[model samples]
Target: MSLPRQSISPLRQRMLEDMTLRKLSDKTQSAYVRAVRGFAGYLRRPPDTASAEDLRRYQLHLVETGVSPMSVNAAITGLKFFFEVTVERADALAKMSPVRVPHRLPVVLSREEVARLIECAGNDKYRAALSVAYGAGLRTSEVVGLKIGDIDSQRMVLRVDQGKGHRDRFAMLSPVLLQTLRVWWRTAHAQGKLLDGGWLFPGMNRVNPLTPRQLNRAIHAAAQAAGIDKRVSMHTLRHSFATHLLEQKVDIRVIQVLLGHKKLETTALYAQVATEILRQVISPLEGLPPG
Candidate 1:
């Protein structure tokens, strides 16, 4: 007996193709597709049959189920795009109200804690990665995507190409980090590895290089070894870098440029986390006798 032929759904296939054709980053494509797929699963049917009422029910379900406000907001955005852009059902999704979330302060690490984490790295790979992260204030993705050519030793600057927002900029390259990178390069060369391609810290895949997840895992392991009690991640390194620099009296505008933030307000948020500023503040009740 002949087996029945499997078929691909037009909607899903179209979504995949659209994602590819737009040249969206793999991470973003995965997130967008997952959010939309979650909506489909919630409806218990194809997304085409979902109405604004269905979407509202899903939103309520998310809140009652204790989903993060960010996740819930992302789901709504995904469904709205699907309905409006792909399905041509704009007005229905547009009428839905958005959930509001209060802005919370970001977690930051102290410079001493950052030093311990880097020092506790078990291997050269993790050490090198964290060194660049803290030394140059690089995002995890930026660190992984670094190329040998990006480091201009003569100028003492690391050229970050197509960072966060697809914009190019330069960051200070510390002398210590450069020396360590030289050692890494020699070790990589001796192994007959280190291809002359895009990435500096290439993954075992070699061609594609290491992922942000792998970097995160390395950081997590190092944090455990260092005995850090604070919740830490790859981004925590970035936060620490920024807050530490601000505490050291570096200009906030300089940090904004280094972090590639489009808005000054975004960089100003570090003020709350800068310990040095808090230390200098005067209390109204200081020098008073006990009541």
Candidate 2:
């Protein structure tokens, strides 16, 4: 009998296995795959066939197409990983360089806006989800990936597992957040859901958790319903959480731990966007009399 042909290309399979071995996040793995596919599409050949010149030309093409430097940089990083790590082609990656990202403060909603937005969620389930997002500063993935076991009612803490960089941490479980979660949990359980240590916010099929797209849409709808337009997303709740806490005189270190930021400077960025801090400042211009 003839040997069977593999459905997946050998290169692609190996790349995936390499990423899995390194324990790269699925998001990062997908980005790397997409970057490799884009490269292949550009050259009309397999990514393995890309030479250093081809990589340079692709970088030029990206910039010429008016792609943001940050996006271009991310694509370059992905391509670097796919070629250097997956394809064992370090020389090909040398010609590809990342663009510098300009520093910008994160967008943050005021405390009142956060409250109104959460209140405007169309239903209890969405409302509770959004509340947890803001109340605990959990990322969209973290919020949707929550398991029932992650909630420590007795300890008054929320367990966040495998957050950014695959790190685990704990967030405070405020009485209000705990109450809202209990309500949603009771309803879900009464309806014969929450099966087999299922996702706290199960998706339609009830096997997978709610997708990020759905969570993003809910946030957008809530922002619109609340009549607040600030380019908000699920992550905006996280920004608001940190900013609001900073405004409340919470320590930057505490906020850093809560947001699961690896660097204190990352948490310190919120200070730049905290309006309360700005409001308390007396400008030197105030010294100019009646200008």
Q: Which one wins on lDDT?
A: 2
Error of 1 at 142 (Å): 1.3
Clashing pairs in 1: 203-209, 203-210
What is the overall TM-score of model 1 with all chains considered together? 0.90
Residue 242 displacement in candidate 2 (angstroms): 0.3
Kindly list the per-residue Cα lDDT of model 1 for residues 1-291, writing each as its tens digit: 111225447786666566677666667666766787898888889988877788778888888999988888887776766677667788768446678987988878787888899989876767888889888889988999898799899999999988887789998888999987887777876775588755678888667777899999888998999999888998888888899999889999999998889999999999998988899998878968888
Q: Give the TM-score of candidate 2.
A: 0.93
- After TM-score superposition, the amount by which residue 167's alpha carbon in candidate 2 deviates from its true location, in angstroms, is 0.7
| Per-candidate TM-score against the hidden true structure | 0.90, 0.93
Q: Locate the minimum summed-lDDT window of 10 residues in model 2.
A: 1-10
Global lDDT of each model? 0.82, 0.88
Candidate 2, residues 10-94, lDDT tens digits: the string is 8888888888899887788888777887888899988888889999999999999999998898889888888778878899977
Q: Pick the candidate with the highest TM-score.
A: 2
